[model samples]
Target: MVDWSGGNDRGAVPKADAIWAGVARGETVEDPVYLRNRKIAEDWIGAFLEDELAAGRRVLAGFDFPFGYPTGFCAALTGQGDPLALWDWFAEQIDDAPDANNRFDLAGQINRDLVGGKGPFWANGLKRDVPGLPRRKDGYVNPFPERRLAEGQAKGAFTCWQMAGAGAVGSQVFMGLPVLSRLRRRFDAAVWPFEPLSAPIAIVEIWPSLTVGPAPSGTIKDAWQVAEIARQVAALSAETLTQILDVNAPEEGWIFGLGFERLLRGTPAPLRNDCFALPTGVHWTPVDEAMELLRSRLSPVTGQETVDTADALGRISAATSFARRANPPLPNTAVDGYGFAGGRPAGAQVLPLVQGRAAAGDAPGAVPAGQAIRVLTGAALPAGVDTVILQEDVTVRAGAIHFQGPIKAGANTRKAGEDVVAGAEILQAGRRMAAADLALLTATGVSQVRVRKRLKVGVLSTGDELVDAGQKAAPGQIFDANRPMLLAMIRQFGHVPIDLGRVGDDADALRARLDSAANKVDAIVTSGGASAGDEDHVSAVLDAAGAMALWRIAIKPGRPLALGMWQGVPVFGLPGNPVAAMVCTLIFARPALGLLAGADWEEPQGFDVPAAFDKRKKAGRREYLRARIRAGRAEVFASEGSGRISGLSWAEGLVELPEAAMQVSAGDVVRFIPFGSFGT
Candidate 1:
C-alpha cells in the first residue's frame, strides 16, 4: 500500500505528508518506506515490484488516489470512457521533477481547451496565479458532476475537482495517474474494475481514510495507515479478496476496499472512561470540540436484557439481530393463478390441467411438463413450476388454461428470500425498535431480542426562590417549572423519570437529596444552582465532596454546565433558567444518556432550510435559536431572551448557527433541528 503525495520533497528526515509505501507478504508486514519525492517513490515502487516478480510472486499494489474522474470526464477529455486511456493521456501531458511539476498548467489547459469551461477543478494553491483556476468555489461552474459513484458511497471523501485545500485529492490524481500508467505498461499490470484481476501484478485505487484508526504512540500517522492497510489486505482470504473486488465500476473506478472496510479496521475504540473528566487544559470548549471529546470518551453503561420481539418497541437493541427465516421462506405465487413451468411463447399458449391444487400451507407437489396447477396467493410453487399467470390474464377452459403470447418466466411469483434472506442482518445494534421493526422481526422469525434496560433518570430542582406548581406562592417565589419539564423530557427520551422534587439553597439538603437519588436512579438531572454563585449549593456540595467538574461550553443560552459523579451515578447540572436548561438537555444530556443506556451516541438529525430572517453572527461561540420551519423556510423567535418561556411552546425546533462570523441573509440555507428528532 502506497500513501501518495503530490507536494514538493521534504528533507532526508522522515515526516508526514511525504510519500510512504508499505509491503506485506502473508502475515508479515515491513516497516513503511518514506520516499522524498514522486520520482523517487515511483522508482522505489518499481524496484520493489521487480524484486517480488523475479521471486515468482504475484503482487497486488494499492495506491491512495482516485483512478478515474466522474463518469463523463474521461470521455470529454480523451473522446472515450476508458480510465486507462485517461491515465495514459495524463502520463503524456504531465512533467515531473524532484521539486516541481506542470499539474496546475495541465489542469488549466484541460479546463480551457478540452472541456471549454472555467472549472470543475479549482483552488490553485500556488503563489502565482494560474489561468482558468479559481481560488474558491463561490462562482465556479462545471459541465460534469462533481463526484463519482464511489465518492457518494464513501462519506467525507472530497471531489476530485478540489485540488488545493484540506482533504483535497485532485493534486494526487494529477500527479499519481501518470506514474500508474507508466507502471502498468512496464509491468503489464491489470487496473482493477477496468480489467480482470488475473495478472502477475494488479494495481488498484485506494482511499486510506476508509480504514484509518488511531496511530500508536511515536508512530507517524501516514506510515501507520499504509502499514495497517497493507497488513490487513495481505491477510484477506482469496474468497474475501475476490468479493471485495467484485464491484461494477468499469467507467469510474471504485475504491479497492470500499464495502469491506471492517476487514481493515485495525481495532475497536476503547470504552468510555470511568468518570466524566475533561482534559487538563480545556477551560471553555467549543461545541464541536466538546462533542468530539464526548464521542471518544463515552460508552454504554447499562446491562442487556432478553425480551420477546412483541415487547421490544422503544427499546435499544443490545446486539445486531439476524433473520432466522426468510420472509417468504419459499417460492410462492403472488396471486390466485395457475403455476406452470413457464417458457417464452411467440403467440397464445395452452397447458393441460394437473390433478391437484395448491394453497397456503399445502404440502409440496409437482407439476408435469406442459401442465398447469391451480394455486392461490402465498402458496409455495409446486416442483417443476417456476412461473404463474395471473387469474385475470388467463382463460380457464375444459382441463386446460390459456394465456397470451410473450409471457415472461417467473411472472407474479414471489421468490424465496426476496424480501429478506435467512441469516442476513435484519436489525442493527443500538437501534431503538419501533412498531415497524417489531413487524419485520416477527416476519423474519426473530422471536426475541437482547435489549438494553431502560435508564432511571432523576430530576431535581434547587434554589429557595422556587416552589412547586399549584401551590400558593410566597413573596419572591416562582413556580418550579424546570422539574416537571425535565421529568417529562426524560420520559420522552425513552427513559424512566424519577422526580427527586425540589431542594432549597442549603448545601446540606442538596447533598442529602443527591445521595438519596444516586442510590435510586442511574443518573440525575439538576436544573438549578449549577454555577459558582453564592446560592449555588448543588455545585458547591458536589465540589466539596470532590465529585464535580464544571464544563464551560461555548454555546449561547447555555455556557456553564456541571458534570459530576455521586455514589457511582452521573449527574448533569444544567442552567437554572428554563430555556438554557432545555437546550442543554437536548444538546448534551440526550446523547449522553443514550450512550449510558447502551444505545449509540447519536446527534439529532438536522435539515438545511432557507433562512426567513437575517442576522449577523460572531465567531468563538455556537448559537442555536428557537425557531420553526414554515413554508420550507426557518424563522427564529422574535425575541432571543432566555426568560421567554412561551417561545419554547411557539417554536417547533432550533436553528443552529455555526461558530463563524458571517452575515446570514434571507434565503440563505441554515441547519434546522426539530425537537422531535431528539425524541422530545
Candidate 2:
C-alpha cells in the first residue's frame, strides 16, 4: 500500500505524514517506506516493481486514493461507462509537472461548468485567485448530491469533490489518476476495473479507514495503516479475494480486503494455498502454429507470366529451366595459334602451317595426319587436331611454325560440353531470378522465361488523429507513419504496394475503402484499431464482410493479429504503434503474404550470442527486444517503450527470448536475429 500525495517535494527530511509505502509477501510483512518527494517515490516504485517482476514474483500494489469519482460524475463529464475511459480522459486533460500542478484551478473550472457557480469544490489555498474559484465557501453549491458508494461505505472518508481542507482528498484524485495511468503504461500491469486482471502486477485502490483501527504505540498512523492493509489483503484466500473482485462494479472499483476486516485483526497473517487472486498465466499462439494455420486457410494464387530474360529480374520462376544444347558442341581452339595433331613428346612443338585459317564460327574440314591448322580463338578445330601452340610464342619461319615452350595434349583447346551439358537442369522452380542468375540463364540458351505474377498489396492506416504527411497537422494530429512504412516494407519484400490512403476511426469509411482496395489488390494491410477499444472499428467493419479473424498473441511490441478475407482477397491488420506495426509486418504478415503469393515459407535465421545486460521476462510469451550486436554481445535499448521510434532506428537486429525463458544475466547466451534476415 502507498500513501499518495498531491503537493510538491518534501525536501531534506521525509515528512512524518507525507508519502509512505508498505509491502507484504509470503508470511512476512515489511515496515512502511518513506518517500520525501514525488520523483523519488516514482523512481523507487518503478525500480521495486522491476526487481520483483524480474525475480519472477507477482506484485499486486495498492494505492491509497480513489480510483473513481462519485456516481454520475464520469458519465456527466465523459460519455463512457467503463472507468478506464475516465482514467485515460483525465490522463489526457491534466498536465503534470513534478514540482507543482494546476489541480485547484482545474477543479474550479470543472465546478463552474457542473455547478454554474462557486460550488461542489470551492476552497482554495493558492495566493492568486483563479477564475470561477471561490476563496472561501459562503454560498457554494454541490453539483453531485451523493457521495460514491465506496466512499459512503467507508466511514470518515473524505469526499473526492472537496478541494483544500484537512482530510480533503480532492487534490489526490486530481493528481493520482494521471500518475496511475502512467504507471500502468510503464509496466506490464493492470489497473483495477480499468484493465484485465490477468497481469501479474495489479494496481488497486485501498481505503485504510475502511479496514484499519488506530496505530500501535511508537508508530505513525499513516505508516501503520499501510502495513495493516497490505498484511490483511495478502492473508486472504484466493477464492475469497476473487469473489470480491468479480462482484465489484466496473465503474466503482472495490477496496482490497473490504469484508475481511476482522479476520487478521491486531496480528500477523498466515500464508494460504498457491491459488492466485487472478488468472495464473497467459496463453498465446505459438509462432509455428500461427504460420501453419494461415497457410492452411489461405489459397495460393500464382498466375503465370512469360517475359524476356532482360525483364525477369527479381521474379519468381514458374518452372524449372534446362540447357537447350551443350556449350561448344564441338572441340574448339581456346587461343589464336597453330593447331597441331601432335600429341607427341613435350619437345615436338614444330609443325607446318596449313592452307586455310579457322576463324570464329568456322569449322575447318578434317586435317590429314601429321598436318597442322592455324585457328583463331573460339574456332572449331579440325578432327585430327588435339593441341594448339600460342602464336605469340611461335615464329613463322619459311613454311613452319615453331615453339620453344613445352606442349601438352589438349592444351589451349576446349572440349565439348565443358561449361554445360545438353538437357542439364539449370534453374529450379520458385527461385527468385537475380541479375547474375538471369545472365547465367541466357548463357544456357534461354530466351523467354516463365515467372509468377507479382502480387498487388494495398497498405492502409486508420486513426482519427492521423493525417497525410504533407498536410498541416492541427492539435492532437500526427502524420500517417504506418502506411508509408508498411508500404515500403511490402515493396521491399518483392510484392507490389498499392496505397489505400488513410481513413478515420469511422467504420463506414474504412469499409468503403477496404471494398475498393479488394477490387484492385490481392491483399490488404491495415495498422491501428486492432486492439479492444471503442475507437477500434476495423474489426467491426471486417465482421460485416464475409470472413474475419481476430487473435491475441503474447509478444512484446506486437498486439493480436486480425486476418480475414474480403472478396477473396486476404487482409492483415497490425497494431497502431509504428514500431509494433513494423515488427508484426516482418515477423508474421510477411510470411503469410508470401504463402498467399505461392512462395515458399522461409524461416528467419538467428545466432546464439551472449547478452550485454540482464533481463527479467514473463514465462509464457515470446518476446523480441530491440538490440544491436556490439563487440559480439547483444545489447538492448535502455527504454523498451514502443512509441520511441529511435529504438527501431538504433537497433541493428533483435534479441529473441523464447516462451518459458525467464531471467537472463549478462553473458547468458540468447538467440539474436539480424534485420537483414527479414530483407529490411
Candidate 3:
C-alpha cells in the first residue's frame, strides 16, 4: 500500500519504514507498525476508492482485511499470531471489541506516534510537542528544537493527532460494507469468521485483484489521455453496476409478450389476436369517420351568397371606358410664354402691347394678329392663340416685344387632354389605396374609389389552466402566453384582430363566444381546447355550431391543429402549447388570413445551413428545432422543450428536420428558418 503522508514524513518514520519494508518483502509486521502503515495507506486508498467504485470494482473487499469487522482487526491478530494468519484470526477477536470506533482509534494512535514528535527521526523537518518539551509562548513546544526555531519561533504549529482518525472510521465502514456482502454471497462461510485465515490462500485470491495491472503498463501523453480512458471505463462500469443493483429485472419472455401486445394494438384488424394468420385487408372507414367533423360543420352547404365589398371606398363604376373629368377645366399654358396669332414672320420683332395676362383658371378674350398675351405656366391660353413663344426667345423693347429668335408654330404648347382624355378609365375596382393611386384618382376627378374591405378576424383563447399576465396564478394555473403570441401573429399578417378575450373550459361559453364572433367577423381564430383531452371543447363547439375540419399534421410541437370555417367564416383552432401555437399560427393561420384578405400568400423563408451538432429525432414527423445561427452556422439552443417559451427568444432561427429523417448528423444539410422571416 502507498503511504499518502509522504509530504508529512510519515513514511520516513522508523516504524512506518519497518512496516513498509515488511510488506514489500511479503512479511507481516507487529500490530503497532502494521496499523500505522495501514493508516498512512488509507489516505492514498480513499482517493482511489471513489474512482474504483464508479468503475464497478468491489473496493470494500480489498480495504476490509478481516472480512466482517468494520475496520479489519488483522494488525491486532498479528501480535500473538503468525503474520500470514493475522487476518484469519481477526474475526474471532472482533466480537470482543465494543464498537468500530475502538478499532479505528487503535489504528489512529499507531500512525500518530510514527509521524509525530520533534525527535531526530522526524523526517518532515518540523517540530511537534512530545511528553517532555519546553513550552513556547504560543502553547506548543518542540522536543528536539532546530537552530532556526531557537532564533525565531515559526508562525504555525504542527500536530499528529489532527491528521490521524480524522476520517478513518467513515472511510473504513463505507469501503467495507459492499465488499463483505459480495464475498459472503460468493464464498459463503469459508470467507466469514476470518480468523485463522491462511496468508497464502488470501494472497492467491485477493492480491492479483487489487494490483490494478501495473498502471496500465504504458506511457501516456498527459493526464488528459489517462482521464479519458478512465471516463470510458467508468461509463461502462456504471452500466454493469446498474444491472447488478437492479431489483425485479425484466424478463426476456415478458418483454417479447408486451411488444407483441403493442403490435396487435397498433395493427388495424378483424385479424388482430386471431389464432390463425389471416391475409391483410384494408379497413374501411365509417362514413361519419371518413368525413371531417369540424370541416363539415363549418362548410358552406349553401351556394354563393350575395356578399358585397362595401366600406369607405365608393361604389364600382359600370362603364368600362370612363373619362377623366378635366382638372381646372380650360385650356392652360404648360410654360411661361407669349400667346400670339399664327402667321407671325420669322425673326420678326413685336411690340409688348399686352392684350391681357392670362393666369390659371382665368378667362381672357381672344388675341388678334400682332398682339401677344402674357401667360404663366398652367395659366389658361388666351382665345384664338395657336402657339406661345418662350420668353427666352423674345426680347421686350420699350412697350413692344421683339423676337430674339425665330418662333416656330405650336412652340411651348400643351395639347388639350394630353395627360388623360376627358373620358378615360382612371382606376379599376378592388384597387387598394396608395399615395400614387390617390393622386391619379384625384386627377381623374374621382373623390372616392372602390376598394376591397379589410377582413376583421375575431380572436379568442380557451383553457381553464390559463390566467392573465401580471396576475397571481391559482393552483394548476399558468399565465396565458398563447393569446398574446397569437395576437401578434394575427396583426403581423395585415389583418385586423378583434380580441374576444378568453373563455374557460366550459363548452357552452366557448359555443356562445364562437357564435357571437362568427356573426361579427369574417373569420374566427382561437388557441387551445382542440386536443382529444377531456377539457378540449372547442372541437365539440364547432361541431354543435356548424361544419368544421381538423387536421393532425405530421409536425413536431404542433401536431394537433384545426382549420375550418363557421357560416362561411374561416375558423382556425390552434394548440395550447405556447411554442406550438406560435409556430402553427405563422405557418398556417397567417397565410390563410392573407388569402382571405385578398393579399398574396408567401411561404416563410428559410436558408440552408450546416447543423452544428448531431440532432436525434423520430422518423415520420417534421420537426422545427429552435437553434441559434452564429457565424453563418445553425447551433441548437439548450431548451428544446416544446412548452418552453424562452427557447423561442433564445433561438435566432429554426432548423427544420424533414419528415423522413430519423437523425441529423453534424454538418448535414439543414433548412435554417430565420426567426426574422416569421416576424420575430
Candidate 4:
C-alpha cells in the first residue's frame, strides 16, 4: 500500500502526511518505508516491483489517490472515455520536481483551454494567481459530476477537486496518475477492472480508511494506515480477491473493497420452494380466463440477493428502491450561456461579466449584483443566479455581455430535485431493472440493491422418435428442436435455463426425468405427450403424481395444456409440435416464469391493424395466426397448420381472431401482437 503525497519534499526526518509504503508477504509484514519525494518513491516502487518479478513472485501494489476522474471528465480531456488515455495525457503535460512543479499551471491550462474554462480543479495554494486556476473552491466551474460511482458509495470521502486544503486529494491524483502511467508502461502491469486481474504486477486504487483502525500511540497515521491495509489485502482469500476485482468501472476506476463489505459479513439466505398447484376442473377455458387464473395463483419462489448496481441489469427488484441523494444534487444550468439573478427584463440589457466561468461539478459561487457569469451546460448555477440566457442571444463587447431579454426568472435553470428527490422511490418491487434504471440509480447515490435470484427453468423433450441435435438420427426419429427453442425462450425471459436432454417415451423414464429435474431446477417445461393417449407419458406421470390439471383451451394451434407439480416443483406440459409448443409457451408459460422469478405478472399488449387477407370462420374458439406487418397491414403465413414449424420462423408476430369470429373483408382491422411484447 502506498500513502501518496503531493507536497514538496519533507527533508531527512520521517513525519505524518508524507509518502509511506507498506509491504506484506506470507506470514510476514515489513516495517513501513518513508519516501521523501515523488522521484524517490517512484524509483523505489519500480525497483521493488522489478526485483519481486525477477524472483517469480506476484505483487499487488496499491495507491491511495483516485485513478481517474468522473465519467465525462475523461472523455472531455482525452477525446476518448479511457482513464489510461487521460493518465498518458497528464504524464505528457505535467512537469514535476522535488521543490517546485507545474501542477497548478497545468490545471489552469486544462480549465481554460482544454475544457470550457472556469474550474474543475481548484484550490491553487500559491501566493500569486495562475491564469485559470482558482484560489478558492467556489471560484471554478466543473463540467462533470462532482463524484464517481465509487466515491458516492464511500461516505466521508473528499471529492478529487480540492487541491491544497484539509482532506484535499486532487493534487495527489494529478501527481500520482502520471507516475502510475509510466510504471505500467515499464512493467506491463494490469490495473484492476480496466485490464483484467493478472499475474506479474498489478496496481490498484485503495482507501485505507475503509479498513484501518486507530493508530498506535506515536506511530504516524499514514504509515499505520498503509501497513494495516496492505496486510489485510494480502491476507484476503482468492475468492474474496476475485470478487473485489470483478467490478465494471473502466472510465471511473473502482476503489478496492468498496462494494464487497457484505460478502465478508455472512452467507446468503437459502432459496424458497413453494409448490404452485394449479386449479382443476378447467375444460375448454378461454384464453383470458386461463391467464387470470395463473396470475392469481402464482407467486415468486426465488430468494433475494444483494448485488452491485453495475451488475443488476435484468434482475428483478426485491423491494422498492429509493434514492440516497437528490439528483441535480445542486441547482445547475440547463444550457451554455450567462447566468444572473434578476426578474425578466423588458428589452435589451448589458451587464459586466464575472472574471471566471462556471462548469458542471464545480462548487457553486455567488454572483455579484448586476453582473453575469458564463455558465456551461450541467454547471451548478451560482448563488444569486435565477435565470440564464443562451449564448446565441448574447453579444460580448467591452468586457460586458449584451442580450435582449423578457426571459423567465428561472429560465434554463434546472432546480435541485428536478429529476429525483432524495428518499423518493425510483424503482418499485417486481420491476425488471434496465440500463436506464442503472443510470438513475447511480446518479442518485444508490450503490447496491436486493434483487431476486434468477429462477432456473429446465427444458425437457420426450418422444420415442426423438434424438438430440448434432447427432445422426436413426430411422423414424428426428432431432429435438423444442428443447433448444424453449431454453432460449427461458433465457430471453430473464430466467436461467437448464437442459434436461431428450427422454424416450416410457412411463418410468419420464418419471425419473421429472424427479431429477425437480431437484435441479425451479420449474420444468416438457414438450410432447401432453394429451391423454396411451403413448402420452407426460400427462400420465403427472396424473400418477396426483397434482395434474389438463386445460382444453379454446385456441387454434394449441389446446391441450397440462399443468401439474412433480416432487414439489411446478411443471408445464406443452404439445409435441414445435409451432404449437412455442405459441403455448408465449401465451401461458412466459408470464408464469416471470412471476416465479419475482417480476410482475405481465400480459402482452396487442393493437389493432388493417388485415390484408380475408377469411370467414365459425364463432366458437379464439385463433392466433402467425403473421407479419406488411404495408401497415397484417399478412399471415400461407400455412395455419400446427406442424408448420417454418411458419414460426417466417412470421414476426401473431394476429389474433377473437372467440366471436366475424372476419370477412380485407380492410377489416385485426388485433396484432408483436413478438417483442413477449420479450423475444
Clashes of each: 0, 0, 23, 5
Instruction: Order the numbered candidates by TM-score, best leading.
Output: 4, 1, 2, 3
**Candidate 3: Cα lDDT at 673:** 86
All models: lDDT? Answer: 0.86, 0.77, 0.49, 0.85
lDDT of 2 by residue, 1-680 (tens): 89888777767765655788988774345667988766788789999999999999988899888888766778877887777777777888776676778888888888788778577777786899877768777887776654777767766877777777788787887878877777888896787766678888999888877776667556777887787677667756788577657645577676665555544342212211111111234345676566666655554454554467888887877656776667767788999988888655656456777788888888567777776878999998887888887889788877888777567789999998898886777787667788988877787677656566787899999998998988999999998888888999898888999999989999988988987897898788999987667887877776666466666776777867776666667778889998888888878888777765656675778999999999999776788889999999999988888787788889998888987869999999999999888877
lDDT of 4 at 194: 85
Model 3 lDDT tens row, 318-415 = 11223446544566677886787664665566655564587776775777666787888887677777678777777776767777546666677776
Q: Stretches of candidate 3 above 4 Å error?
A: 1-331, 337-353, 369-371, 384-394, 400-415, 450-454, 484-496, 530-536, 543-546, 552-560, 577-591, 594-680
What tens-digit string does per-residue lDDT give for candidate 4 at 1-680? 99999989998899898999999774234668999999999999999998999899999899999998888888887899878998899899889999989888888888887555578888888888988888886656787889988889988788997788899999999899999999999999998768976758899999888666567566799998887677677657888888788888888998898876533222232222223344455457898988887887778777665567888999998767778789979899899999999656689898999899999888999999889999999999999898999999899999899888688888889999989998788998899999999999899887766577899999999999998878899999998989999999999999999999878889999888888888999888999999999888999889888877777888888899888888777899999999899999999999988888889998898989999998887787888899999999999999889888889999999998988958557988999999999999
Highest lDDT: which candidate?
1
TM-score per candidate, chains pooled = 0.60, 0.53, 0.41, 0.61
Best by TM-score: 4
- What does candidate 1's lDDT look like per residue over 382-492, in tens digits? 998899888888898898998786778898898999999988788888988989999999998877676777889999999899998889999999999889889999999
- Candidate 1 CA-lDDT value: 0.86
Q: Using alpha carbons, what is the TM-score of model 2?
A: 0.53
